[model samples]
Target: MMKFLSFLLLGFAFLLTGCSEDANVIEVEHPEKVTVAFFEALYNEKNIEKAASACSPALARIIRHYRSPQAVARHMFNMSYDKVEIKPDDSGVKVREQFKNKAIITVYFDGYYQENRIKDVKRLSLIQQDNKWFIDKILKDPF
Candidate 1:
């Protein structure tokens, strides 16, 4: 009887662990993370609304106008990937510039498109409103 009770408790614990894993909401606590999450939602997860949540109202509207994640990725961002690894560029060449309520960050994308590898870099302008960072614009690539 004790063994059966222990097994049931273990099963319940496993169930709880699985439930927590299912709630995979991205965290956007910082500018770099927000940028990464935005691309991940758009490219890998293919979730347009989730991606747009990290953008300014104007930018979000522009993104939504594409109608689908694929359209947004292709026409709007000009990059599409089957799998992607996105990160902020930390090469010390150009450090992240943060002003009173605005910041500029550069992000790097290394991914595959149709089994071919591709890389791209983007400089993003961000603004803080109500203590939350929103992507205001995608600056022209400096590379």
Candidate 2:
């Protein structure tokens, strides 16, 4: 009887341990981080897929026009940021005539393209679809 009880207790313990719930891990993406990641992927990593992941669908369409992914990424090598801001307006409801599914990110930076150093600001408009942000449009103010 003693041996039987020991086996039963061991089996019960194993069953209890196996019944634990799995850990739930959720990933949250911040707009500021996404902006930095976009540039990093474009320049440092030279990865078009990764960089394009940070853009909106409209931008993705444009990126496809390049001869290759590398060509698309090369456009960012001379870009450097000074400041960034994200404004999340009502992206779900019709209130005060705000956007329904978009966030505006303003990036102040220095553009050094073709040996021309220029202080400029680019506004990145992002859209949320299926819980992910994508670059939709880039509005640049020439310096």
Candidate 3:
């Protein structure tokens, strides 16, 4: 009976470890993916530090200055959502505009705040350093 109880506890511990929040983090292997992950972490997960992890050092410092996900989302990004769905614009290769170590990606945000629907588009510039993509800046909206 003692051996069976120990085995059961060990199995439960493994299960708990597998269910940790870290498991839900998105792995950004590409420029567009990083842009999407940035907004998702900020708007959906409401995690400022996690969102800043996808940014360049300069941009991350700016984001961190806000100190809260809501502040970053509202002031920096100029939008807020209780829940959001982000997708890269799939227009074409010409639209994506990826170069050797730089890329410009456009993403769409569909979200809601207090039952009010909101939709916005953002253009992001990214740079690759040490083979990892980081968000460099958010371009001004043209429209």
Candidate 4:
């Protein structure tokens, strides 16, 4: 019985051990790839809510970011343009360091302008809070 208890405890510890790194050394499941694909699907469908849904909640207060999934949904449901699309450029994460229950993603992408086929690139910073990722802020770097 003692041996079994020890083994069980060991297993639990292993499962609990998710590594957390500072700044750039964090390990995560293909964050960049997932972000890219998610954006593609959301923009192509013009499903703004679904697009914002991929992001987290804590990032709402940041400038150049969405307040909530509902906010995005409302905007999409009530947009003057009615047609907005996002195309990703190259994406790299800034804060790979995993927190207790959050992560951050900074994505660089290009989007199609609604007035015409002209394209405009946008660099977006996102935060993952409560197991969800959301827009953190809009960045100004092209590269």
- Which predicted model would earn the best lDDT? 3
What overall lDDT goes with each candidate model? 0.83, 0.55, 0.85, 0.44
How well is each residue in 16-110 modelled by candidate 2, as lDDT tens digits?
77653211111235554566566555544555666666776667667656645456634632343223222332245432236556766665544
* lDDT for model 3: 0.85
Residues 23-53, candidate 4, lDDT per residue (tens digit)? 1122234445446544553444544444444
Off by over 4 Å in 1: 1-27, 92-97
lDDT value for model 4: 0.44
Error of 3 at 61 (Å): 0.9
State TM-scores per candidate: 0.77, 0.51, 0.80, 0.39
RMSD of 2: 10.7
Q: After superposition, how far is residue 63 of candidate 3 from its true place, in Å?
A: 0.8
**Candidate 2 CA-lDDT value:** 0.55
Compare the candidates by TM-score and give the number of the best one: 3
Please give the RMSD to the true structure for each candidate, in Å: 5.0, 10.7, 3.1, 11.4
Q: Model 3, stretches more than 4 Å misplaced?
A: 1-27, 94-98
Higher-scoring candidate on lDDT, 1 or 3: 3
List pairs with backbone clashes in candidate 2: 55-135, 56-134, 56-135, 91-100
Question: Clash number for every model?
Answer: 0, 4, 0, 4
Clashing pairs in 4: 55-133, 55-134, 56-133, 56-134
